[model samples]
Target chain A: DAGVTQSPTHLIKTRGQQVTLRCSPKSGHDTVSWYQQALGQGPQFIFQYYEEEERQRGNFPDRFSGHQFPNYSSELNVNALLLGDSALYLCASSLATGQGWFLGEQFFGPGTRLTVL
Target chain B: AQRVTQPEKLLSVFKGAPVELKCNYSYSGSPELFWYVQYSRQRLQLLLRHISRESIKGFTADLNKGETSFHLKKPFAQEEDSAMYYCALSPLGSGGSNYKLTFGKGTLLTVNP
Candidate 1:
């Protein structure tokens, strides 16, 4: 079975530009979440998508948005990116338990390295 | 606000030596803690969770509620154990498909043979 997959292993952009990263969830999984891992730091949650809607978001600004398709794939869009936005964009997929408590194990992709100059 | 803190940025150890990575969390309510690992050229994956109370690859972490910490430990380190280890925490009721995790800065473990 295929695990979570992300596209465009690496990308380069300039300040004020926009970028969209994609992710396909693991088989039998329905929820997808996006994270940003800056150099020398662990990942910070960007947002989570469930039932085609954003279910939870982190401390990120409005410039960061996401979409979850019916097939459980996801897209993370960052508009007007800044130099600080340059980081490794990670995609994690997990099975939603529906009860609002205790999510199962999360499987992460190889991550798309975004560099904003 | 929930937070996870891993004080060590890098840890080096000789093969067959014991290893311990420290992790501390700040959360008012009940929290779920986890340890995730990423080896060179491999995707990040879960190593273990506090709820499971099970060990993986000789690594085990105990949730010290009184101290608000979850430290990963192994009796004998192996060369292949070198990787980036991350500590993560999630609120009690906000997990699963709708989960939002707060992660530490992570510690890079280099086990030398």
Candidate 2:
């Protein structure tokens, strides 16, 4: 099923510039989430999208926004990139059920390594 | 605030030896714990979750609410088991916050032959 897929395995940008990362959810999955993993750190939740809307958000600033398309593909947009923003951006997909979104397993993609200078 | 902690940054063990990866969490409400693994050049994937109570790739984790810990254990470590393991926590509820995962720094396991 190709599980989850991400584009542009690696990216480089300068401070104050904006960057966008893309992700395609696994087949039949409707929920997508974004995470940031700094070197030597685990993935930190950024936000989650479901039904083409942002259903959940983390502690990230407003500069970090996202959009989910009807096809279940998502995009993470980070404006005013800072040096600290240089990290591995991960995109995860899962199914949303009546029980709870947390009940379903999240499948992750290979991740996009974003380097902000 | 919820947090997950994996004290060890790196762990080394000889093949066939028993191994345990420690994980501690801090959360006020009930949290669903999970173990995720990332092998070399591979994407992160779920290894197991506390609720399932099932072993995956010979690894099992037991959640102790009193101690607030979920440690992953394997009876006999294999070389293939070498990878980066992360312990994550998800709040159990119906709110939007419940969908996000809180993850530990992760433990890198290296099995020697």
* Number of the predicted model whose DockQ against the real structure is largest: 1
User: Per-prediction count of colliding residue pairs?
Assistant: 1, 0
DockQ per model, Cα: 0.66, 0.59
Q: Model 2 chain A: which ten-residue window has the lowest total lDDT? A: A96-105
Model 1 docking category:
medium
Q: What tens digits encode model 2's per-residue C-alpha lDDT throughout A33-71?
A: 999999999999999999889988889999999999999
Residue A75 in candidate 2 has what lDDT? Answer: 98
Looking at model 2, give its docking quality level: medium
How well does each candidate reproduce the native contacts, as fnat? 0.82, 0.68
What are the lDDT figures for the candidates, one per model? 0.91, 0.93
Per residue, candidate 1 scores C-alpha lDDT tens digits across A1-117 of 778999889999999999999999999988899999999989999999888998889999999999999999999999999999999999999887756534677899999999999
lDDT of 2 by residue, B37-100 (tens): 9999999999998888999999999999999999999999999999999999988875322558
